[model samples]
Target: MELKKILCAVDLMDTVNPAVEYAKMLADMSGASVSVIYVISSRSTYENLQVPVEEIAKGMRRIWSRSREDMDAFVAAYFPGVDATGFIYEGKPAEKIVEIAREQDVDMIVMGTHAREGLDRLFFGSVANEVVKSSKCPVMTIRPEKKSE
Candidate 1:
């Protein structure tokens, strides 16, 4: 397929590098421009509020600022010399990813998964799983490599 644009979903965690690498590889092969998206789930940011609304808002701002820094660092580290645009979104990760992919008209999506299965998958629903199910374009999920001791 002739890929013009590629969307990469990253959580800024252990899976970030592997997912970015996979996306970069695909983009290189297909001559596609890569855009990286990092979603900060509202559930984690706005839940269990024990403080005032202003305090909550302040906390969210701080989180967003930090997330932006992390996203920039991630791109600089893993995608140096590549023109990768980074985006930060607020909401459920899976939904935000799919929305961005569709809005950007990306040819494909590359993301990383923890590879949770069985009861784990049932309890903590996988974002990658959800994206694959809901995405209009093709979704490619990569598993992070295990570190050797």
Candidate 2:
């Protein structure tokens, strides 16, 4: 299928580069535009009850601002001189990703897989797995390269 636009979901972590590079390669090959998205999960916004609501909100704002800067740097690093738009959304990560993909009408969704297992996977669940299952469009997941000993 011809890809006019591609949606890339990143967490602005170590996994981001591989996913962004893969998406960039695909976009270059297919002559498609790329849109990068970072989701801030609602659960991440919660803190100690004694912190106070105002403090929580202020902390969230700081987090958002820092995240935005990181996102900008990420795109610049991976997609220099390319016309890629970056987006930030707040909610459950996988759900927001799928929703944005559908809303944007992208041809494919690109994301990174952390390859969690056992208890960790069971407790936290896999965002990539959820996105793959729920996304209306095709999902391409790039696993981070194994680090050498």
List the candidate 1 regions with Cα displacement exceeding 4 Å: 43-45, 49-51, 147-149
Task: Report lDDT (Cα) of residue 60, candidate 2.
Answer: 80
TM-score of candidate 1 on Cα atoms, chains taken together: 0.88
Candidate 1 per-residue C-alpha lDDT over 13-125 given as tens digits, one digit per residue, 9 for 90 to 100: 55434588888888777778889998987845565755677877788899899989999988888777666888999898998999999999999999888766689779988
lDDT of 2 at 137: 89
Q: Backbone clashes per model, in order?
A: 0, 0
TM-score, cand. 2 vs. native: 0.89
Where in model 2 is the C-alpha error above 4 Å?
43-50, 147-149
| CA lDDT, candidate 2, residue 148 | 12
Estimated TM-score per prediction?
Answer: 0.88, 0.89
